[model samples]
Target: MRSSTRFERDAFGPVEIAADRYWGAQTQRALGVFDIGEERFPSCLIHAFGLQKMAAARANLRCGALDPVLAEPVVAAASELRDGRFDAHFPLTIWQTGSGTQTNMNANEVIANRANEMLGQPLGSKFPVHPNDHVNASQSSNDSFPTVMHLVTVLELEERLKPSLVLLQESLRERANAFANVLKIARTHLMDAVPMTMGQAFDTFARQVAHGFDRIDATMPRLLSLPQGGTAAGTGLNAPPGFDVFFCEEIRALTGRNFSPNPSKFEGMAAHDALVEVSGALNVIATSLIKMANDLRWLGSGPRCGLGELKIPDDGLTSSIMPGKRNPTIAEVLAQACMQVVGNHATITMANASGNFELNVAKPVLIANLLQSIRVLADASRVFAQRLVQDVEVNGAQLARNVENALLLVTALNPILGYDKVAQITAAALEQGVTPRAAALSLGLLDEATYDRVVDARTLAGRPGHRPEGFSERS
Candidate 1:
């Protein structure tokens, strides 16, 4: 018989795998049947799982269930995994793994095998401690998976999203300051209204992002409230007296994860309101991003045919067939990411409803979707800010041209010319191909110098009490 067959025959029951394969026949069949590519779950999630195992192993040591011989290796493996060292061991196909049992066992077997190797033992041999009894001593997937999800999400938010949000806010503030002096016609309901400074419009964008960041940060405290210490059924069955508190503390120490005992372990295991809150928060931020990106897209629409107020960098062709075409692809991506976040939130909501008394079987789906939302929001925020917003050039000439062309600037003149005369001058300016000032002068509504002084966009956009020299408020 082949060495692989002999090895399998000695170690396992009638089932066996070929010598060339590390996994058994079941894994081989799963690999073939699912044939899913190397696309495993996020590496961060896998790292989180490893961190949980390490934390649990350390907790077990504190509980007198594991010796340093075993605990040391677990901690080392976890540290390596967290630093992105062992990626090959994480390629378990997601489809064939019913109930994620294969994945759980895979993690166990990988860690055990690695620990054994560290102890100068052959691979595939359970050493001084077993993978299940010692390493996963007091935990179940019901507890561990969700805990990992929470840890990864919270860490990503703090480490990645928070900084990116600050950068975006800074970018917006810079734009607001740069455009502080430019004036543009304000529109309500897509119709012309009074005048406002371009600074105000940019400031509004900054305020929207700031509010989203605040809301996201505000939601962090809720996320820190975790579902740890809830063992199989939240009863802490088979767990030592102080295991919950001590384990949470150990987790905090090891992973820098500040987890607390679920106030009601029963409710915690039986439901996922925390995940719902997270999803809701992500949806809110995604909605904000949609609004902000759409605003940029519309504001930067056209140099010739559209709004043409701001110009965006040309990253890609807007249309494949249209000549000289460039579209707001980045903004479009933000819109799509926002839609995905909304859909992911809906998925989380549905998954949250799937829990029974003791456990929610839809955990995999919830974690998957929730992580999707986090990654898409984080990545899209970074790209939209860096690629599109930061380097974009403002079309000051076009802005001035449009402002000068706008008949709405004449609204201020309405106070001087009466509404009828202002409307007539507006029409004549359009028809006679002259400046509103020249048209007003032709019609004797006002002199050239006075019209110029009073119709000044900057003076009008100034504070209510402020005006240019020789210009007085009508009221």
Candidate 2:
């Protein structure tokens, strides 16, 4: 190990740390032991880690628990971490300790070393600001990790995810209003059932997205409840009096988000139902996006053969094997992204359940999956809004052709000709590949003049100013 340069000793004995890195002995121990997947918690959490520690330092300083000489360097080091200057030091995998203690100490050690260095001390010197004793005072891994989870999730939801959903909803709403007069065949069981305005179809999808947004809004209060005051099995032992309240206040100032302590620290520590609730709400959104994406892909399936209600926006990609062929690339990728989020919710559910009596040990997996879900959902919403949903074109000519030829249009004649007569005309129309108008004429079910006036698709779709076949309403 390069002649054991820059050794630091912990309870585990002397271990070598990377010479240029800021993390110390405990973090080095974790790096040696856990060699799981390369996927790490994102750098945003590192920034959150910095904000959390800095809040603790400020809280302790205000309460006179920390000496000003020792606290200033810690505050400065934490600001660097929060500002994203020290993300490289937090390279541990997401599959580390169950309570995220390794990641916690990872943050702790880096801050301690950086703080000491600011005082003209060497890298390994823990004199002025010891990692756990000074940097982590009034906190524990159990409380601190979960608190950062809340901070990162709530901030991202407010700043990124909610606004993206609004953009998507507005895009869909615009299309609905624009297509208000365009009539199309509505399908059930993949077969035409009735006539309806295309606006109705797009409006239904917009409502689904709006409903998902409302569901998430309802869960925000529960998600914002922080477990930071719990401090190791919800007991808050070895912490200064009134530290929890002060910590929450400092964090509120730092983030501009009021994250209050959970009413029951034992409940917060023993189960992660709040984060699971957030994931569940996101899962429902994933389901909504998946449905809309699949609908878009199918509607835009073919320029020549399929439903052809829509034309997908050109994404500048082509099939390497087929010439001049474009795909619904954004919608397809959106489906895949939503599927990953649904699967992540499953992982979170299991982790949420695996926690025991006083403390849940599956915090790292929960944190990893929750953050991943947020990123995927936010990214997919933006792409769907800008590239696909906003840009997709309605095939007006195709919709007109399909409505004119639809065998199901025979249903509109049911009241005049009765159900049996209309069914016969529908079967004949389907078998001969002819318009229902032609079948009605051949079967003597209606005259040419009556067929022309009665089969107006816009009238059958209940559009305003519709008058059917000049027959009196009382008759």
Candidate 3:
């Protein structure tokens, strides 16, 4: 039954390989052992590994560890992988060996076979470019794998996630400035508290997102440090001199982002604290998004039922039974996405703590969650900003009515009418279900003219010695 299959061998012994593919025996063994999940290392990770392998081959050649004849084709093959040519070849799951040994070997075999093909040799020749002796020469899964992790994470943060956050922040800021004239009653404990401009409320959300940007910036210096020369257990053993430096140089060239070698390979290989720090920043961002999203839901709720202080775009989502109903589906999406990010952050934190003396047994999950957090936050921010923030319409008349009915405007009345009188008026209004202004007038706290000037929401929010629109203070 096994007679027709092609055989490949590793140091372990002979094995079967996919007939048309380039990967060798070790990758095949990993595929057979660990097919538990559908989650594969992303193509971004594969591309970074290619970049690393290509750079490693050149560094080995320069350091006199690999022959130039092998180096050329390896470089070519590695370049193709880096350029995303063989992304489909990286089929190993994220559920593989903790150090990502299987993924590393997968890269090695794919690059080797491809390199040998470029040299007019058969796929498994292992001649001009042996997967281990040449392409992975001077590196181990410990150094190479984590270096790729850092590369993809750093690039994604700068290229996509960070920029998306800034975009969302700017969009919120623009709306904040535009909404300054639109007044609303602020809520505390779900009750009307005081007068705050719509602009002020939007600005608060912008400030929260801006703070998240600052938090992430603080983690960059550590996140950009590569563990490339650490080799197996951080001992730089087989990795030749200049490998770390060259790897950093190559990284800078490819990404246009600055990176440096880890000062201690042992520290780099043994722990994943940098990624944990990133997850913490992402956790804060998730909370910020949750606040903003929930606030929008409250503001946009009930065109006829709840607390509809603002109008959101009816993105055509209708209740199954009620054809006229449009719900806050995008806000719900943001909330659900934020919850996922929070959960993933917890996973990453545990993964960070799960490391033993030498290496984190959960580096794969740690980076996986970290990257997921970045991408989800970035996406939610973009969608919320465009669909929700940009289109949000303040129900100014309703806000004004709520402000007039709120007993808390007694806060403004206190300084003018004295605390005892204002307190008496507030209790009287609440007990009688009367408006605070009416209660004050009935109690003879002030004449109608004085009450009008002193208790106006516009005056309370805008100026110290303010008058109504037509009042003459001198008269």
TM-score of each: 0.84, 0.93, 0.93
User: On residues 313-385, what C-alpha lDDT tens digit does candidate 1 reach at each position?
Assistant: 8896657688888889999998999899999899889988988778876776677778878888888888888
Of 1 and 2, the candidate ahead on lDDT is: 2
- Give candidate 2's root-mean-square deviation (CA, Å): 5.4
Prediction 2 global C-alpha lDDT: 0.86
Give the whole-model CA lDDT for all candidates, comma-separated: 0.72, 0.86, 0.82
- lDDT score for residue 105 of model 1: 54
Model 1 spans > 4 angstroms off = 1-39, 93-102, 316-319, 410-456, 462-475
Clashing pairs in 3: none
Report the lDDT tens digits of candidate 2 across residue range 1-475. Answer: 5444598988878988878889999888888899888989988889999999998998888877788998899999999999999989987999888889999999999999999999999888887889998899888998899888888888878878888888888888778778888888988998887888877777777777777777887888887788776788898887777777888898999988877878787888888888999999999999999999998899888889877998889999999999999999898888999999999999999999988888889999998999999898998899899998887778999998888888888787888899999999999988998999989899997899887787778888886323235322210
Winner of 2 and 3 under lDDT: 2
Best by lDDT: 2
Q: Candidate 3: global Cα-lDDT?
A: 0.82
